[model samples]
Target: MLVLLAAVALTAGSVSAQTAPTQDRVLRQGQKGQGRMNMTPEQRADLQAQRLTKQLGLSADQATQVKSIALAEAQEMQSMRSNVMAGTDRRAAMQSMKATRDKYDTQLKAVLTPDQLTKYTQLREQQQERRQDGMENGKMKMKVKS
Candidate 1:
């Protein structure tokens, strides 16, 4: 009876362990923009600057510049998003958003080295692909549900 109880306990522990969230799962949830909307523009800028610093080996000056640009971009984006939510024409909003992004990219290029710019471009492309894949997956899931 004791041996059987021990085996049951071990099985229960293993099952719980299997059900526990992994670090990767947690990171994925965060990456899905959970809680992102609540962050202040400064917070968003800081996060972006930190990521760029890590990815591009940015100097302190460069990071500062990047943070400023990110802050401005974040604020602009927030305004644009609010405008769109308030019934502004989506096509016009999208065009404005694209122009904002282009301006931001130009500012970034001025701050980054040539190699860093290349790397940043690649990273942006990867992000775009991921976004497209995520949208496609969402559409597939919606279709499946229907």
Candidate 2:
């Protein structure tokens, strides 16, 4: 169970990491030095919580709690990004980010039904695999490994 949670957390990271290159590309093309969408971390978290709610079919209370969890995670991730840029111990910061993501995964699991959790894990793994393949092949072709 612990191993599964770790994998889920790592897969979640990979899913988010997949978007980084696209965002970087946007910045490169934009005339502004820092081309970022005007989104507060809270707003971003709300969007994530909404996505999770749709995917997991969460109840109202669960959605609220998950949004709170997502908001905290977003704040922490921002801090981790700053620390990485500030020449803090990169590896340690990454580990801490992983741990923080794991904590969010654990909380989300508690709020999800057994079936929902199973589906969520599978979805994240599929996304991670898609991302890995896209990186290597220059196109996404979904295939589940045995």
Candidate 3:
């Protein structure tokens, strides 16, 4: 009887351990979103400036200016994100966000050279395509061939 009880307890313990992660997953799934968007403006600016430096081979002066631009945009975006999370209309909020993004793109264009602008445009298109391809849970939508 002692051996049988020990085996049963071990089995139950292992089963609970395996299921703990699944329970956490279910809890997250119940939330309305994927995760928090709480990056600080300085952090966001640094990351964006680094990406621009790598992609466009920007000068130090240009990277500094770009970081300033990114910081401003990040501050605005953080506000927008908070409002959206607070139950602002998602579609309207998105439109406002896009308008803000376009304004930032214009600011970036002013800082970039012509060649850099072309490369930036291409990069943005590629990013948009990638984003569209992977929206909602990493499931890629397939087009059916007629």
Candidate 4:
């Protein structure tokens, strides 16, 4: 009876251990990027600069410049979002956002080497594809619910 109880306890422990990571993964996926939205502009900029540094093998100077640009862009975007939320015309806000992004891209291009720029372009395209796929999937899910 003691051996049987020990085996049962071991099985239960193993099962819970197997399930814990899955539960943690689900929670992580749900909360991913939500915390970033709550971060200050400087924090967001630092995060972006770090990501770019890793992705593009940026030098210290490049990383610093990127961080500066990212901070300005984040602040501008936040202001734009606030304006929209405060009943500003969305179309104009969108245009202004696009202009801001264009300015950012131009600045980024000046900083990156040609090879890095090419890689960055490819990365952007891949991200756009993923975004499109996600939107399509979301539309399909919405249709299924309706």
Model 2 RMSD in Å is 19.1
lDDT (tens digit, per residue) of candidate 3 on 1-146 = 99999999999999998877673454344332333244467866876787789889999999999999999999999899999999999999999999999999899899999999999999989987877877754665566799
Evaluation by TM-score, superior candidate among 1 and 2: 1
Q: Against the hidden true structure, what lDDT does model 4 obtain?
A: 0.84
In model 2, the runs with Cα more than 4 Å from the true position are: 1-38, 138-146
Worst lDDT window (10 residues) for model 1? 25-34
Estimate, for each residue in 1-146, the C-alpha lDDT of model 4 and write its tens digit.
99999999999999998877674354345336566667778877877787788889999999999999999998999999899999999999999999999998899889999988999899899988977898888842443553
User: What residue pairs clash in candidate 2, if any at all?
Assistant: none
- Per-candidate TM-scores read 0.72, 0.66, 0.67, 0.72
Clashes of each: 0, 0, 0, 0
Model 4, residue 52: C-alpha shift (Å): 0.6
lDDT of 1 by residue, 1-146 (tens): 99999999999999999999985554345455646677778877877887899899999999999999999999999999999999999999999999998999899889999999999999999988988898888842443553
User: Which ranges in model 4 have alpha carbons more than 4 Å from their true place?
Assistant: 1-31, 139-146
How many Å off is the CA of 51 in candidate 1?
Answer: 0.5
Candidate achieving higher TM-score, 2 or 3: 3
Q: How much lDDT does candidate 1 score?
A: 0.87
Q: Give the worst 10-residue stretch by lDDT in candidate 4.
A: 23-32
All candidates' lDDT scores? 0.87, 0.79, 0.84, 0.84
- Candidate 3 lDDT at 54 equals 85
lDDT score for residue 131 of model 1: 80
